[model samples]
Target: MTKPTPLSGFPELLPAQRIAELAVIDHLRRTFELHGFASIETRIVETLDRLAKGGEIDKEIYVLRRLHADDDSSDSGLALHFDLTVPFARYVLENSGRLEFPFRRYQIQKAWRGERPQEGRFREFTQADVDIVARDELGLHYDVEVARVMAEALADLPLPPMTLQTNSRRLIEGFYRGLGVADPHLVISIMDKLDKAAAEVISRRLVDEAGLDDEQALLCLRLAEIRTRDTSFVEQVRALGVEHELLETGLTELAAVIDGCADVSSDRFRVEANLRIARGLDYYTGTVFEIYMEGHESLGSVGGGGRYDA
Candidate 1:
């Protein structure tokens, strides 16, 4: 008999590791429920079209197919979900009639992404997400509310200290538009690489690819460099000499979330307004977040999410 090769991305925990994982999950489940978030589980697979709504994510999706299936099998269109939000949105649409207003749901499930597996990221991994869906309008307070819940959850965990770095899509877009950039989204896409690429590389991309002049590129870099633990970031951005109604709205909203989370956040789990955290996803309309733990900064964000008003 041949010895089986261990899969690189799919993790198999030993008994002790499994127990530890279960304990962590249980703690998160309890924390979420205590905050009035009901637990729910979504199906593992969604149609490729539905999952492909975010174009960039399509490359990271694992398509589902049956063994020895026909060339044109109907199952070929299905794929394992890359994240919980897309499925949750689909669930809301399908079950809208049965759900109550301002639905608070906490989903803990295994999500699959086909991206290269690295520390803190996996091809198959358990993800815990808390989201509040409303029928019409959702107050900005819910943004702060969800952050508080996650902060408390992480603070209670037995892991290293964590920081919840946050930013606003409106803020980034408004800043770019105020700078008179022809395409704000294009600039955003380039700015999102600040964490991975060096400042010089990003500056070159902004000028060559995004068609930004040297001055505009320099300002964009300045905006991305803003990081603060309090609302003082408002003045920092204002000092840049850009003004837009949406920029003011994003500044106010981002400040509110920072201040709101500050009250509940612990020393172990801190919150900061990090402008470089422009989530690549197009759906996120308002606030965005990226969670990082001490001593594991190189692994990139262990967790993140944002408000999708659409």
Candidate 2:
């Protein structure tokens, strides 16, 4: 008899868990549609160049090739969609004229990643996303409202408490530029790894590898550790002797988001200044968000997204 084979990283949920997951999905879909987001879907395969835009996502992509593609000419390195955002961006660009401005849409689909997956992190998993993209620019208030709605949808889930750690890329970039940092992207990339790497290791790498001085590297590390529920985090960052127009602007927008969601009784939503939440995608140009489980902080972000004004 042939032996049975088990797939690696791909998970199978128990009957009870599947029921719970379905209930969660159904609730989220209804909430999203209620907010006027229409539904859409994109094809599974995308070209290699589009998938490899930022270099970081390349590692996670699961490349595909035709069965008869034996030569380099046929080896285009198409890949399974790693996340919903990239495909959505391509969809918007392709269907620009036919689509309405400030397009609001919801996409729920399975995404594949070549990751060493664990319980929550899987090789193939479902992502339920709701986003609003404008032809020109989206207002900051809209950004806050999306976060508010998402929080409400997940409030009843039987999971650990989660907080939306929000920050603005414009704010961080401005601060870095004002500090005379020549390569802000490089700095942001390094800072994004703070959660995975230790403070000492990060500081050393920034100083020795990225050419930042000890003081600057230390300051960046300290900023990564600073998190809060409101604009209070801004005062803490200011006390560190770092003040810049971009940082202040980010703080102001974050304050508006906190105030807008003030009616939400759950403390699960907060504004954290030290949130070094660079989504690592080149498209996101404004406010970035990260959802963290309260007790399982080390498991990394469970959900995240940001505004892409390009």
Candidate 3:
């Protein structure tokens, strides 16, 4: 009898690792509930059009259908959800009248992505997300509060030291619009890959693949490389003659969040200017996040989510 081979990109955790994962899940659930975020579990499948609302997630979806069934004539195009946010959006839209304004909820579940996974990256992974969605608009304070709660939860976990990096979508969108970038989303996507690719590779991809010019790509690279412990990046960016109302607003909002976090302690949180963190999904609108473990920074972000308000 021949031994079976394990799948390439899919990973199976060991007994101890599984136990640790479960413990983490338990901690997250407890923290979320304590923060007044009610738990909600959505259906595993969503329609194609609903999933494709933002276009960023189209490449990651795993389409599904019944096996050995003769339903070829049917127009069913169900897909496994790539993240918790879209289903939450659909759920909120469907249950809007019955639900209260600023519906706060937390969902922890496995999401499937059909991309080629690398080391420490999986085709299917579990995500624990807590979000506050309002009917019209959620206040900015909620953004800071969400980050604070998430930071606290991660800090309490039995893991290495982590940093919470954040950026505002409204601010980025406003800045890109000011820069006259025809497709800011494309630029954002390219910028998101900065950590994975070299500067030249990312620059070429931005120009060739994203339709940005050489000068624009260099500017984007420069913007993405901006990092600071304080709000010094704001001054540097301003010195570069990059003046945009949205960018300024983003700078102010970032300052407030950094200051609020400083009240807790400066060591656990940082405001990174070069943190070109786009969650690469449709549901996130403002305040994106990416958490990095102390020594496992190259393993990619272990935890990430952001504010999404329509």
Candidate 4:
């Protein structure tokens, strides 16, 4: 008999590990259901064009093809979904007519990507996501609502303590535009790499690549450095000596999220306003989050997602 070699990214878990994983999944399912978030499932594959809309995520997608398909067949394209959000958005549009307004959905499924495998990185992994989709508008309170659900879910698990660090896209967007930044998105892309990139490297990129003046770049970088365990981040922004209407709105929204979280799991979980934690996705128009274990920065964010108003 021939032996099969283990693949680097497509991991295979042993029996004990699989058993432990099932227990975690069972807990999450129960927690989500208790919060009135109905469970739903999307197909494992979606069109390549749909996933491509994820910006830089386009490069990490894994396209699918039949082994015996003709070279010139007219099929447009197909790819394994890289994450649940893209597929869920498509689902909302496809089933809009039959569904109720303000749909709250909880999905747990395996998502695939072609990225390099590392300690907190995965090529194929199981993910649990809770999202609220509205016909036109989603209330800011749901932002806090979802976080509370996740906080409770984490507390029930047997893993080490974790903190759900949050930031607002509105906050960053308004702060940058207020500072006279030419391209805030470009600066955000660079800022997202701060953990691996040096401060000087980020500042230089902000100047040379994004064409921001020294003053603006410095302010943006300084804003990114602010981290608070509670609502104190509102004061930190004021201390920066800059103001914008959008910044005001974002601060209010973020404060609301934090305060709402306190009501749900005060002693069970932690929430922090981490300004530097900008998600690379541009669609996340409101509050954003990244959860990590205490003192385990090397493991990276174990779970995260936020509002996508579009």
Candidate 5:
């Protein structure tokens, strides 16, 4: 008989808010389909083992439990999916025999995560993802294509100007290797916090946790500071004197993506190379992306995705 209590992380949009969101989703759908991306929906729940394949999000996964069910129930190993990309990968594997090579698919669905909710982040939220997957190999050109499609979709919407910040895992990993860092992945995990933490704090963590020497930590910080709208970033990284074949490959690939997206970029949308964007997930390889609205920078990334090994 008490009044209903509102949950903090579960957001409920009002009629007006929902109308606006639907319109945006619709526009995204049209844009995606126009780009030859077919629509698909994945199950909300996946086996914990399969979900854990994504990365270090085991703590944030929402386990599925059934009331009045026995301990031996088949649901014991199930949990709600944290992100669409993980599930999409599973889908591709399960249906690989029927799907075409370099299959482009778009999925807009609710995903659940048990993280603290603040600003743009929520425990339960709807996400739209567009991914292109292949059987044996995937071309790099699809990377540029997807970025342009998303940028065009956002431009037609009534949102503020957007910037798609990009980085390369090959670049980060190779750079760390060149520095003789013992654990490049661990360093990346710590460096990903550059946006949320101060330079001094990250530098200390890099030295303490990632086991980097003082000089190496300083160099890592220097690498993280490089950002550019064009291929100018290439010189900045080379100036640091780190050399590795993977680093060179990443530099060329990332530069191509930025240059390729240049034609579609305008006052509304732009793509830039930001070396500090170490997207926290170990599965991400090659090019990584993070989209941000100009005035809402503090809300964290509005949208983000990255390439993974097939």
Candidate 6:
């Protein structure tokens, strides 16, 4: 008889391991309920059309296939969801009639992606998300609320010190457009790699692919280097000498978010205004978030999400 082989990405924990995992989930559920957030779970699969609405996600989806299809039979146009946010948004739209304004919900589920296994990265993982979605318009205060809730959640868990690095897509986009760059989105996609790639490599890509002059590329690299815990980042961006209404608005909004959290005495979890956090998703039009442990920065963000007003 042949020995059974385990699938590469799909992991099955031992009985003891799963018991420990369930305890953590219980803590999260209690914390969420304590904050008046209702729990809701969506189906594990979503339509490929919805998943691929944002072009950047095309490479990461795992398509579902039928078991007994003929040669000419096509896929069912469905795939396992890569993350919880996309599915949650679709659910809100479909059930808009039954839901209330400014809905507060918490979801914890497993998600699958087609990513290659690498150090500090995975193809299958569990994600816990807490979101406050609204009907007409969501207040900026909720943004700060999210930061506080997540920070408190992490503090409850047995983890090291954490820093929630946040930035505004509008802030970066406006900064680029103010420089007369025709495609700020493309510039942002490239700038997102600043952490993985060196400044020279990014500058070269900006010039060769994104069509930026050497001077403009250098300016972007300088901007991406700014990281601050307080409102000092506002001064750093202003010193760049690039002025625009969007940029001004973004700076003000970003400052307000950082300050709002700070005033809540959220010092248990450090928060910072980090300009280099682009989040890669185009729909993330407003502030973006990326959380990292103090000494485990190389592990990447343990959790992240942001405003997508559009």
Number of the predicted model whose TM-score against the real structure is largest: 1
lDDT of 5 at 310: 46
Counting only residues 3 or more apart in sequence or on different chains, how many pairs clash (N, Cα, C under 3 Å) in candidate 5? 0
Compute the lDDT of residue 206 as modeled in candidate 2.
85
lDDT of each: 0.91, 0.79, 0.77, 0.86, 0.89, 0.87
Higher-ranked by TM-score: 3 or 6: 6
The best candidate by lDDT is 1
Q: Where does model 5 exceed 4 Å of error? A: 1-5, 52-56, 65-76, 115-120
> Per the 3 Å backbone cut-off, how many clashing residue pairs does candidate 1 have?
0
TM-score, one value per model: 0.92, 0.86, 0.80, 0.91, 0.90, 0.89
lDDT tens readout by residue for model 6, 1-310: 9999987777789999999889889898888888878899999998888888756568989888877667524568889998899899899999999998799999999998888776646678899999998887888888888888877777777668888999998899989999888899999989998889988999999999989999899889988989998989999999989988899888999999999878543545788999999998467989899998878888888889899886
Model 6 Cα shift for residue 25 (angstroms)? 1.6
Candidate 3 regions off by >4 Å?
1-15, 52-60, 67-76, 115-118, 173-190, 200-221, 266-275, 279-284
Off by over 4 Å in 4: 69-76, 117-120, 265-268
Writing each residue's lDDT as its tens digit, candidate 5 over 1-310 gives: 9998889899899999999999999999999999999999998999988887555578899988888786657878899999898789889889999998889999999999998777667899999999888777778898899899889889889999999999999998999998999988999989988888999999999988988999999999999999899989999999999998888989999999999998988898988899998779567888998999999888878988878874
Pairs with steric clashes in candidate 4: none
User: 37-143, model 3: which lDDT tens digit per residue?
Assistant: 99999999999878876575588888887776577446378889988877988998889889987788999998888877676667788888888888786788887
Ranking by TM-score: 1, 4, 5, 6, 2, 3
Model 2 lDDT per residue over 1-310, tens place: 7996668878778999999889988888888888888889899888888888667567888888778766856568788999898899899999999999888899999899998856667898899988888877688889877887788777767777777778778767766766667787888888887777888888888887778888888777776667776667667777777767887887677667766766763755443534577787467787888888888887878788888765
Better candidate by TM-score, 3 or 4 = 4
Q: What is the lDDT of residue 21 in candidate 2?
A: 83
Question: What clash count goes with each model?
Answer: 0, 0, 1, 0, 0, 0
